[model samples]
Structure formats: structure tokens, C-alpha cells
Target: MISKTTIDRVFETARLEEVIGDFVQLKKSGANFKGLSPFTDERTPSFMVSPVKQIWKDFSSGKGGNVVAFLMEHEHFTYPEAIKYLAKKYNIEVEETERTDEQKQEADERESMYLVSEFAQRHFADMLWNSELGKAIGLTYFKERGFTPETIKKFGLGYCLDQWDGFTNAALDKGYRLSYLEKTGLTIVKPDPNNPNGTRKFDRFKGRVMFPIHSMSGRVLGFGGRILTNDKKAAKYLNSPESDIYHKSKVLYGIFYAKKAIAKEDNCFLVEGYTDVIQLHQRGLENVVSSSGTALTPEQIRLINRLTKNITVLFDGDAAGLRASLRGIDLILEQGMNVKVCTFPEGEDPDSFAKNNELEDIVGYLEGNAKDFIQFKANLLAKEAANDPIKRAETVRDIVNSIAKIPDGIKQEIYIQECAGIMNVSESVLFSTLAQIGKKESTEASKKQRQEQKAFDVVKNDATVEKVDVQYELERKIIEILLLYGNNTEKFEDLVLKESETGELVLEPESVEAKVYEKIYLDLQEDEIELANERFRTIYYKLIEALNQSENFSLSTFLGSLDQEMVSEVSSIMMEEEKYTLHNWERKDIYPKDKKIGVAQLTSETILTLRCFLIKKRMSALQGETREGTQDNRETLEEIMNYIQLNKLLNQKLNRVLS
Candidate 1:
């Protein structure tokens, strides 16, 4: 467990915007930061971070909380892991109580795999720098590739010794479990046929140089290792097998190092391998990542989609394997992102190309040579289809199909026109082909939907309608009001029933000045109203106590005291109205009512509405009792009448007509 003192210092030092900005591209909105939702595939900015409140909200996914919550959600970190990440990021010394043997044994399985992978990375890097054989074999190979000492260290380059059990023995000696070692694919184990109960083990990447693959948050998920010698029996490059923490299709090499730069430049350079990423970064080009030669996946594309909508895929000069990568562009288009292609000179790949040129030459070449996906695909296919009618027709269909993958209608129409011009076909012909492709796609999608529906035996409904939960909304509003204005003293004009000089009961405005929390608590207490929602009721008491005890209640401090569930509740409530402030509502001459202008009125009305709702609920219960019960009919009738009168008075004070 992390010490309270250390967690507090981490919370104080680590800024929410700064930590989230590492993975997201945040642009400044008025008083807040807005970005594309990392939790959803979105084109518009729906993720909002309020530095003032020290919380973030994803309007698209409805996930909201403080900085720690963001890490827990985005990075999939356990609570302790998140705190430790913050401590590391902000340079705070972690003070954790020593774990007992039982506690150590109870650590999470996925986390155990992660720890093994990280330790392997360290062990390999240490061997590369310290061990004699590692220096002679692995270090020499990286130097021959023109990587600098600094570049090598920056990427955590390492070497596994050639001995079969070198890494396995080191990890075991350090008390790392063999199960995790095998699970992360660092140590491969096999049954020893000679002895029934014994097993044989070997380092998976023995005699190879290691490149650590990290997640966006910089935790080593796995490694990609390159062999130094040309052993025909063994593969040239070896990657960690898919485990709990590392999925090859989902992990982008160099994403941890390149995420900030990718967002800053609003573009990404997609490459084919590990060194391609390192070479570019070493040449001062930082917004670059690779699929590690794996075929592109939607999950990987969505990872980049969270940062920017623009991608410029970098290809080597070799025509082989070029068409395979071209298909990945259509996947990008499906996600509503822009795609461009840049190829190096003949006989040069990104690694060699960047290794030879200065940064200026590289930038100029990429800028001057980058082709839009449409032109690039057309030009490449036209050469192969030269004068062959069948191939030419097929190429045109392929291009049109790629265009059809675009989600935007306007872009589709514009690209169809552009493709017509490029292929020397009429626009109408291309449009017809695009239409056919879209129709086929829609039909297939509907077929799949029907199949899924049949499998689940779900009933078809005309619409998915949701009725309003009035009590739930009222309880939420009460919490929102208390959170936003609990510390502020406001003048309130509440309607009080009084006897006038004419001896008739009439509602009169009774003015009073008190803190917002004071008014809310007193009103609820007076009515003996308990929140119907259990979660809201729990938060209600906590908020009231915190507000009453502190002269200055800090929202950040208050948030730190609650569990994640309540923290999410408070953040959503406080930030719900702030979403209207995004996209600059006033500049379009459509101004929303400023919430600060009438906080007092809002608070009074909310309390009045809750009282009305509860009273109506009580009257409904009494009516039900009158129907179901045989005794006490007169007293129950009088109780219903009393509740009805109270409900009417609350509705009147709220300026609502009772229907």
C-alpha cells in the first residue's frame, strides 16, 4: 500500500491536464481543455478536462473522474499502479509499506506478467552494456546499423546472452516467478521427456538485441528482438508472443515516445518496423510509429485516431509488400481520418533514408513527395494495369471501393470526382460503382445484424425509448448544486405559507442569507426528505458533513477523500453544465444562459422540485393503501389530502402549473 503522505504529494504535484495531455491532443477551450474522446471513436472533441476542478469528463462515453481515475480507465492501471505512475512522473519518492509474503502472492496476474516483461527489458539492456559477449555481439550489431550510443539507450536497447538459460536464470535468481516468465514469453519451457517431473527452459530471445515495446503510458508491454547472425534455421526478428499485457495487433512500436509529438504535429508517420521509428526519432522526426510489420488493425488505427485525424504512412522503395500496406489506408478512411502516402527513393527504406540524410532534407522530401491516398493508390495501380482492360477495370473498382469506405458523404463525392479525373473515366460511372459498393456493404451489415438478433432471440422494437427518472434527476441536481455552490453564501427568497392580515393563508416570499449547503441541508431536514437513490444518499451525507466542517471546502481535496465511484458522480454532476460552454456557444449568436447568473434561483427551485416530487410520491402511496387496505380509511384520506396540499404549494413556489 502507498503511504497517505506520498499519495497526497503526488496528487498535489501532478496536474490533470499535463498527465492526460501526454496521451491526448488537447486544445484550449475557454477555461478548460477539449480533445477527442480516448474512450470512443469520435471526430469532434467531447472529452473535457477542467484544470480548475482537477477532473475530466468524456461526454461521449460518460466516463468522468479525477486524474487518477483517468489513468485507471485509460491505462488499465490498478489503483496502486496509478499512484506509483504519478509518483514517478512527478518525481515523488514512493513510501509503500513492505508487503507480506501472502500479499505478494496475491498480486494481480496481468500485473505480474507486466513486471516480468519490464524486468526482462532491464536485464537485456544491462547485459548489452555490461556483459562481454553482449557487447561483442549485440552492441556491435546496433553500432553497425549507425545507431548512436544515446539513441540506443533512449529506446532501452538491450541484448540477451547466447546461453540458453541466461535470462531465465537471472530472473529466477531475483525471485521472479517462472510462471510469469513463461506467460510473458520471455522464457520458453518444454517438458523433459527423459525425466517425467522435470522441465527444460531457454530464453526466448537468446543471442538477440532487444527493442522494448511500450504502451502509450511507457510501461514495457513486450519486446521486439533482432538476431545478429544470419541463422537460416532461426527467424531474423523475434517478437514477444501475445500475452495478457501485449497484443501485437494493438500495440504500436514507439507510441510511448511518439504520442506527444504526434498530437503536437497533428500527423503520424506509419512505418513497417521497429528501427524505422527509432531512426526517424534520431533524425529529429518524433511523430512516427510502426505496426512492427503486422497487418494494420482497426484497434491500432483507433489508437492513433485518439490523437489526430491525419496519418501519413511511410513506405520503403521496394514495390513488394507495398500493396499489402495500401489496404490499411481504407481502414483509416473508415475511421473518418485523412491518409497520405510517402515513399522513399528507390533502394532506400525509412531506416536507411533517415540514417543518411539531415533533418532538413528528410522534412523537405516528405513534404514535397507525400501524395494524398487517392493519387497514390491510383498512380500505383495504373502502372500495373497498363493497357490491360481486365486489370484496369479491376483497379478502378478497387479504387472506388476504397473511396466507398469513407464515412463522410461529401468526401466520398469529392473523391469520386477526383478518381474519375485520375483514371480518365466519367464521374457518373465512378459514382455508380461507388453506389454499388455502398449498397453491398449496407446489405451485408443488415444481414449480420439480423443473424446476431436471431442468435440472441431479441424482440424487435419500434424505438429504444427511455422514460425520465424524475426522482433520480432531482437527487442528482441536489448534489450538483451542493458541489458547485456549497461554499458560497447566497441570498435566497423562499416562499413561506403565512396568515395574512385578512386571516387567509397565502404564500409570501421570506428572504434569508445563508451558505448554499446550509439552505439545502435545512430544507431537506425540515421536510425529512431522504434521497431515494442509495448512491446519492451516501454522497449527500458526506457532502453536507464536509461543507459544514470546513470553512473553505476545496473540491480537489474533497475529491481525494472519496472512492472512485463517488468521485465519478461528483465530477459528472459538476461538469455536466460545462459541456454547453464548449464549441464557443456565444460566437454563433446562440448564447446559453450563464449558470453563474442564477445559482441561487437554481438551488431554491431544485429543493422545491424535490419536495414536490416526494410529496406526490407519498400521496400516491396513500392512495394505493386506500385501495389495498380495509381499515383506517378516514385517516389515510386525510393524510393524502395533506400531502396533496404540500405538493401544490411546492409546485406553486416553483412557478409550475399543477396539471
Candidate 2:
């Protein structure tokens, strides 16, 4: 367990901007910083980070909390992992106490999985650097691919031996659970063919160079292995299957490493392979990430969109996969990303080119060669179409469809003009086609939205009706005042309702528990009644006890007295509004309004209001009573009229004081 001292240091030193800046590009927006939502694909900024509050709110996804919570949400980090991350960021040494075996056994499944994954990462890394076969084969292969020692270590590159059960045996020998190994897909388990009820295990990535896939916070989630040998039947690459912890579709290669740089550069370089990422990073272009050679997914693009809107995708001219990969540009556009495509020279990929040339030269080549998506598409298609009208028409449709994928109207218009210019087609004709596709898409989107709205409405309407009670609102307002003005020591008396022997209303002055809102409400009531807002009411009682028991109260100490949820809610409310300064009123030549000045006048006004309400309530209660000009009812009506006239005079006096 992390020590209290360690936890205190973490909270004390952890800066919101500094911690979040490691993964997200945040631009100053008023007192808070705003960025693209990490949890969704958005062009416009919707994620907000408040340095003063040490919290973030993602308007798009509606997930919000402090730094620890952000880490838990975005990186899937445990509380301990998040604390340790902050500690490391602030250079605070952590102190921990050892736990018993039973206590360790009580660790949650997620934490255990995280621990097991970390162990596996270290195990593979050790094998890569230490094992004879690993050094001779995997290390040799990495070197042959022009990967440096620093690059290999930076990426946490590793290797698995050729032995069938090598990794599984090692894991078991270390007292790690065999079940977890099978669960993580590090080991393949099968029912023994020879034995009736027994199972056999083999390493999943035998004789493969390992690449550790990490969560945004850098915890090892899974592995991606590349084959070294020229085995025709064997697949060239293998990834860990989906498990309780890792989802392949949501994970991107090099995100953990590239997130900071991507945010810093305000752009991300999208590539196709793990090598492409490693090579670019080696060449000091650390803002590059790969889709792991898969088709660009909305999830993957969203991940990049969190860090930046601008994306430059690099494709190799030598590779036969250009046309197959071109579809990704449309996906990028759909996510409202600014996409540019760059192609390396024929017979060269990013990896080879980086190795052959200096970093400056490589960067310059990429910058110079990067072409806007529409222009690249038009130029590539123009070569194929030549002067054939039919082919040109097909190309125009393809470009228009790509433009239709863009969610932004301004970008679509700009791309349309560019496409027309490149295709030698009229802007009007191209726009007409774009309009048709866009209209269809919009109609479908609207239909989906309507369906979703209907579902939402059904759910909303199905909710049980809650009875409206004004008493709850009154109690909440009282609590707000108590929480705001509780510290003031000046004597402030409030009127409480009391009942006399005749059951007539009587006003009594009460000096009650300061900041004890529930007590204040109870004290005011002629009859004892419990207030709603149960959580605050509960807190109010405890605070009263604390205040009565102690000579002096500290706001922070009082705040620290509650559990996490209560603290969060109470603190948020308390800090939402600033203290109204009498200084400002004084500057405007206004005197501080004495809170008690209107008390006598407000008393008459209150009686008048209550009389009106009581008369109505009584009338409702006496609905069956056929009291035709009865003496009691007549006297009640006459008394109410007199009180209303008196209230008019009271209002004039109160208004004069307020003015």
C-alpha cells in the first residue's frame, strides 16, 4: 500500500496542466484550458481542464474529475498507479508499507491483471536482452532492421524463445497464475489429446520479436509480435487476443509514447506499421503513431483527435498497399481531422529512408512531399484517368464522396474547390454531386438522431413521477447560505414559527447552531419535520456536532471530515461562487446593507404571505364545509386583509433600506 505521506505529496505537488499536458494539448481558455475530447472524435474543443480546481470536464463525453480520475478514465490506471505517476512527475519518492500474503491475495482482479502484465513485460524484456537464443535471433533481427539499442529499450522491445512452453513455464515458475497467462493470451491452453481431462500450454508468440502495447498511462496492456523466420505457413505477425483488459480496436501503437509529442507538436503523423512508428521516433519525429497496419478506425482516429486535429499519414510508394490504404483518408475526414498524405520514393519506406538519410533530410522530405488529401487523390487519379472522360467522372465521384465524409462545412467547401481545380471539372458540377451525397448523409444522420431521441424520450417518459416539494428547495437554499456565511461571528437572529395554546401563529427569535441548516429548518418549523436533501442534512448534523465540540473550526479541516463523494460535492458548491466584497459596493458609494434592517418590515411581509397561503390551504381543507358567512371564516378573512395592508407599508420601508 502507498503510505499517507506519499499520497499527501502527490496531491500537494501534482499540477493539473503539467500532468494532462503529458498526454493532451491544452490551450488556455479563460481560467481553464480546453482541448479536443480524448474520449470522442471531435474537431472542436470540448474537453476543459481547470488548473485552480485541479479537475477536467469533457463536455462531449461528460466524464469529469480531478487528475487522478482523469488518469483512471483515460489510461485505465488504478488509483495507486495514478498516484505513483503523479509522484514520479513531481519527482517525489514514494514510501510504501508491505502487505501480508492474504492482503495481497485480496487485490482486485484488475490490479492483479495489471501486475501480471507488468511482470510479463519485464519477463519478455529480460529474455530479449539476456537469453542466448533471444540475443542471437531477436536482437540480431532488430539490429538487421536498423533498430538501435536505445530505440529497442525505448519501445520496450522484447523476444520470445522457440521452445513450445518456454514463456508459460517461466510464468508458472514465478508463482504467477496459469489462469491469467491463458486469460491474457500470452499462453495458448488446449485440452490434452493424450490425457482425458488435462490441459497443455504453449507460448503464444514463440520465436517472435515482441512489441509491448501500452495504455495511455504506459501500463503494458498486451503484446504484438513480429515473426523473424521465413516460415510460409506461419503468419508474419500476431497480436494478443481481446481479454478482460485489452481491446485491440481501441488501442493504437505508440500512443503512450507519442501522446506527449503529438500534443506538443499539435499534429500526429499516422503510419501503417509498428516499424514505421519506431523509425520515425528514432529519427526524432516522436509525434508519429501507427494503426498497427489495420484499416483506420474511428476509435484510433479519436485517440489522435484527442491530442491533435491535424494528421499527416505516410504511405510508401513502393508498397502495393497504397490503394488499399487510401480509404483511411475518408475515415480521417469523417472524424473531422485535417489530413495530408505523404508518399516515400518507390522502393523505400519510412524505416529504410530514415536509416539511409539524416534526421533533417528525412523531416524535410516528408514536409516537402506531404500533400493535402484531395490534391493527392486528384493527382493520383489524374495519372490513371489521363484524358478518359468516364474514368475522370468516376474519380470525381470518389473525391466528392471523400469530401462528403467531412463533417465541417468550411473544409468541405475548400476541398471541393481544390478537387475541381485538379480534375479540370467545373466547381458547380462537383458541388452538385457533393451536395447530393451530403444531403443523403445528413438525412440518414437525422433519421438516426430522431431514432435515438425517440428512445431517449421513451426512457425519460418512463421515469417515475416525483412529487414536487417546495420545502426541499427552501432547505437547500438555507444550506447554501449556511455553507457560505457560517464563518461570520456577528450575531444574526432569525424568526422561528411557534404555536400558542390557541393554535395561533407566534414568531420567536432563535439563536441556533451556526451553519447547521437542518437544525435551522427544524427550529423554524412550528412542528418538527425532517428536511429533504438527505446527504446535506446528514452533513449539517455532523458539522453542528463538530462545531459544538470544538472551540475553533478550520474550513479545510471541516472539509476533510467528509468522505470523498461528500467532499467533492460540498467543495464544488462552496467554491462555485466568490465572496461578495463590500469593497466593490463601497467603491460605488453604496453602504453595506445591514442584513437585519428589513427584519421587522420583512416579518410583516412574511405574515401577509403566509396568511394568504394558509387561507388557500384552509379553503382546500374546508371544501366540504358549507360555512355561509361564518364568524370564524369572516374573522380570518378580515385579519388577512389587515395584514396585507400592513405588508404594503413594510414593503416600502424594506425597499428604501435595500435601495
Candidate 3:
């Protein structure tokens, strides 16, 4: 477990903008920073980061939280993992107590896989640097590929010895379990013939150079190993098998290194292999990542989509390579991202091209040669369909399919016109084909929606019904007031009922000043009202405790003590009104009434509303009891009359007119 002091220090030292800016491209907007929502597909910037509050909100997705919460949400990190990541980023020393054997055994399965992967990364890196055979072979291969020592180290490049059990033995000796080793695919285990009840283990990436594939936060999720020897029976490159921590289809190689660069450049260079990413990054082009030679998946595209909206796919000039990668362009287009294709000279791929040229030449070549996806596709396919009517017709349909993938109507029409001119076909024909494709896609989409709706209705009908708590919103509002204005002292007017000279009860108003927290606590206690939401109730007591203990309460300090869920709820409530501030209301000739101006009235009204609601509920229960004859008839009658009068008084205090 991480010590409280270390966690506090981390929260203090880590700046919200600096931490989030690593993954998001933030542009200054007044007092806060705004960016396109990483949690959703958005053209407009809806993600707001408030450095003053040390919290961020994605208005698009309705997720708001502090720094640690963002990491947990975006990177899928555990709490301790998030703290450790921040400590490393800010250069703060993490103080953690050693886990007992039982505690170690109780670690989460995903965390265990991560720990094993991290151990493998370190072991391989140490072998590459410290072992003689590793240096002689793996180091030689990397250096021969024109990768510098710094580049290799930066990427955590490493080597595994050729002996079958080298890595497996070392890991076992380190007290790492063989079960995790097999789960992470670092050690391959099989049934042993010599021992009846025992199993044999060997290294999975034996005789290979290792490339650690990391998540966005730099946790080693898996590894890709390239074989040093030319073994015809073995594949050239081997990747970690699917496990609790690693899913290849959802991961992009070099994302940990390239995320910031991709955000900074507002563009990404998509390539085919791990070396392609390292080599390009080594050559000062840092915004490059690889699919690791697999077809691009929507999950991977969404990963990049969080960073930027423009993707320039770098293809080798090989015809087969170009054709295989062209399919990825449509996927990119479908994601509402701009797609450009840049092919290297006839013989050179990104690796060789970057290694052979200076940075300026390579950069200039990319900028000058990159073609729009439509033009690139048309030109490449036109060459193959040259003078063949049937092939050309098929090519036209293929181009139309790519065009139809575009979500924007204007873009599709423009691309269609461009395709018509490129194929020497009529615009009418292209339009007709695009319409047919769009209609077919719409029909398929509707069918899928109907099927989904049917399933949803079945589940909805079969699921246990939950009673909606009508007091929830009122309870939530009261909590919001406490969190935002709890410590604030303001003048409040209280209405009191007193005996007049004629011996009749008359309403009178008295002005008083008190801290908001004190007023709220007294009001709720007087009425015996408790927060209906369990989470809200927990936060309420904590806030009251903080208020009672501290004369000078710090929002940031108080926030650090709460869990992620509370942090999110508090931030949402705090920033709920600030969303209007983002609209620049005054500039648009629309001025929103500021709630802070009547903080006392808002607090008093919220409490009064809750009191009124509870009174009505009591009255209803009394009426039901009277009908059921479960209570004394006279007592129930008197209780109902008292509740009615109390409800009327609350409504009057709330300035509600009687119907």
C-alpha cells in the first residue's frame, strides 16, 4: 500500500494540465484548457481541464474528476498504479509498505499480469546490456539497423538468450510465479513425460530481440520479439498472446512514446512494424506508431482518435504492401478522421527511408508527397484497371465504397466528383452508385438497430424493477450546496412563526448571518432528514467532519482524501454551473443569473424543498395508514393535519404560491 504522505505529495506536485497534456492536445481557453473529448468522438472541443481546481470534465461524456481519476478512466490504471505513474512523472519518491505473502497472493489478476510483464521487460533489457551473447547478437542486430544506443534504451529494447529456459529460470528464481509467466506468454509450459505430475517450462521468445509494448501510461502490457536467426519453420516476429492485461487488436506499438507527439503535431504517421515506429522516432519524427503488421482495428483507431483527427499512413512502395494497407484508410475515414497516404520511393519502407535520409529530407518528402486518400486510392487502382472495362468498373465501385465510408455529405460528394474525373467516368454514374451504397448501409443499420432494440426490450421486461426515489434530486441539490458553499458565511433571512397580540400565530422574518455548513447541518438535524443517496450521505458526513476539524479548509486537500467516485461527484457538482461560463454568455447578449449571488437563498430554498417533500411523503403514509385502519384514527388525523400545516409553512418560506 502507498503511504498517505506519498499520495499527498504526489497530488501536490502533479499539475493537472501538465499531466493531461501528455495525452490530449490542450489549447488555452480563458482560465482553463479545452480540447476535443478523449472519451468521445467530437469535432468541437468539449474536454475542459481546470488547473485552479485540479479537476477535468469531459462535457461530451459527462465524466469529471481530479488527476488520479483521469488516469484511472483513460488509462485503465489501478489506484496505486496511477499514483506511481504521477510520482515518476513529477520525480517524487513513492513510499510503499512491503506486501505480506498473503497480500501478494491476493493481488488482482490484471495487476499480476502487469507485474510479470514489467519483470520480463527488465530481465530482457538487463540481458541485452549485461549478457555477453546478448550484446554480441541482439545488440549487433539493433546497431546494424542504425538504431543508436540512446534510441534502444529509450524504447527499452532488449534481448533474450537462445537457451530455452533462460528467461523462465531467471523469473522463477526471482520468486515470480510460473502461473503468471504462462499467463503472460513469457514462458511456455507443457506436460512433462519424465515427471508424472510436473510440468516443463521454456522461454516463449527465446533467441529473439524484445520490444516492450506499453499502454498510454507506459505500463508494459506485452512484448513483440523479433527472431535473430533465420529459422524457416519459425515466424519472423512473435507477439505476446492475449491475456488479462494485453489485447493486441486494441493496442498500438510505440503509443507510450508517440502519444504526446501525435497530439502536438495534430497528425499521426501509421506504419506496419515496431522498428518502423522506433526508427522514425529516432529520426526526430516522434509522432509515428505501428499496427505491428496487423490489420487496423476500430479499437486501435479509437486509441489514435483520442490524440488526433488526422492520420497519414506511411506505406512502402511495394504494390502488395500498398494494397494491403489501403483498407485501413476507409476505416480511418469512417472514424471521422482525415486520411492521407504517403508512399516512400519504390524500394524503401519507412524504416530504411528514415535510416537513410536526414530529418529535414524525410520530413519534406512526407509533406510534399502525401496525397489525399481519395486521390491516392484512385491513382493506385487506376493503374491496375488500365484499359480493362470490367476491372475498371469494379475499381469504380471500390472507390465509391471508400467514398461512402466518409460520414460528411459534402466530403462524400466532393470525393465522388474527384473519383469520376479520375476514372474518366460520368458524375451521374458515381452519384447513383454512392446512393445505392448509402441506401444499403442504411437498411443494414436499421436491421441491426431493430435486433438490438428487441434484445433490449426483452432484458428490460425480465429485469427486476427498481423504485425511483423521488427525493434523490432534492438530496443531490442539498449536497451540491454543501460542497460548493459549505464554508461560506452569508446573510440569510429566516421566517419565524410567533404569537401576535391577538393570540394568533403570525409569520415574521428575521435576518441572521451564519456559515452555510452550520445552517445546513442544523436544518437537516432539526427535521431528522438524512441524505437518500448512500454515496451522497458518505460525502456529506466527511464534509461536515472536515468543516468541524479545520478552520481553513482546502478543496484540493479535502479532495485528495476521497476515492475516485466521490471525487467525480464533487467535481461534477462544483463544475455544473461553470459549463455555462464556457459559453461566454455576456458576449452573446445572454446573461445567466449567477447562483452565487443568492447562495444563502439557494441553500435555504433547497432545505425547504426537502422539508416540503418529506412532509408530503409523511402525509401520504398517514393517509394510507388511516385507510388500512392500522393506527389509532384520531392520532393519524391529528398527524396528517400537522404535516399539512408544516408543508404549507415550508412552501411559503420557499415563496411558492398556493394553488
lDDT by residue for model 3 over 1-659, one digit each (tens)?
Answer: 89999998998888999999888888877778888787887767778888887888989899989999999898878888899999999999999999788987887888888898999999999999999999999999999999999999999999999998999999989998899999999999998999989988889999999999998889999999999787999999999999988899999999999998898889999999999899999999999999998899988898888778899999887747667678888889888889999998888899999999999999999999999999999999999999999999999999999999888999998998899889999999999999999999999999999999999999999899888676987878877887778889999887777778997555688999999999999888987888878989999999999987887876777889998889999888777766666676779998778678999999988888888888888899989888999656998898888777767777877779877
* Candidate 2 lDDT, 1-659, residue by residue in tens: 99877776677678878888777778876556777777776677767776765666676675666667777777777777788888887899999898889987887777777777888888888999998988999899899988999999999999988989998898899898988888888989999999999999999999899999987778888889998889999889999999888888888899989988898788899878899889889989999888886778888888887778899998887868677788888888888789999999989888788788988998899889999999998898888898899998998998899998888888888988999888888999998998898789889999999999999999998898888664554455444445544434433344545677997555555653343333343344643434457886787676656666665554444543455566555544543332233123567877667544543333333333343344444454454343554445755566555554444433443343212
Residue 207 Cα positional deviation in candidate 2, in Å, after optimal superposition: 0.9
User: Which order, best to worst by TM-score?
Assistant: 1, 3, 2
The TM-score between candidate 1 and the true structure equals 0.93
Candidate 2 regions with alpha-carbon error over 4 angstroms: 40-44, 59-62, 446-531, 538-659
List model 1 lDDT by residue over 1-659, tens digit each.
Answer: 78988887887788999999998888899889999899887777899999998999999999999988999999889889999999999899999999899988888998888888889989999999999998988889889888999999999999999889989999999999999999999999999999999999999999889999999999999989888787999999999999889999998999999998998899999999999999999999999999997899998998998788899999989848788888899999999999999999999999999999999999999999999999999999999999999999999999999999898999999899889999999999999998888889899999999899986665545446689999999999989888878889999997788887997556788899999999999989988888989999999999999999998787777787789999998889988987887767779999777777998999998888777777787888889999999886999998887677767777777778988
Q: How accurate is candidate 2 locally (lDDT)?
A: 0.75
Off-target runs (Cα >4 Å) in candidate 3 are: 25-52, 56-64, 451-468, 568-592, 625-636
| Residue 228 local lDDT, model 2 | 84
**Model-by-model lDDT, in order?**
0.90, 0.75, 0.89
**Residue 165 in candidate 1 has what lDDT?**
99
- Clashes (N, CA, C under 3 Å) per candidate: 0, 0, 0
- What TM-score fits each model? 0.93, 0.79, 0.92
After TM-score superposition, the amount by which residue 373's alpha carbon in candidate 3 deviates from its true location, in angstroms, is 0.7
Shift in Å, residue 393, candidate 3: 1.6
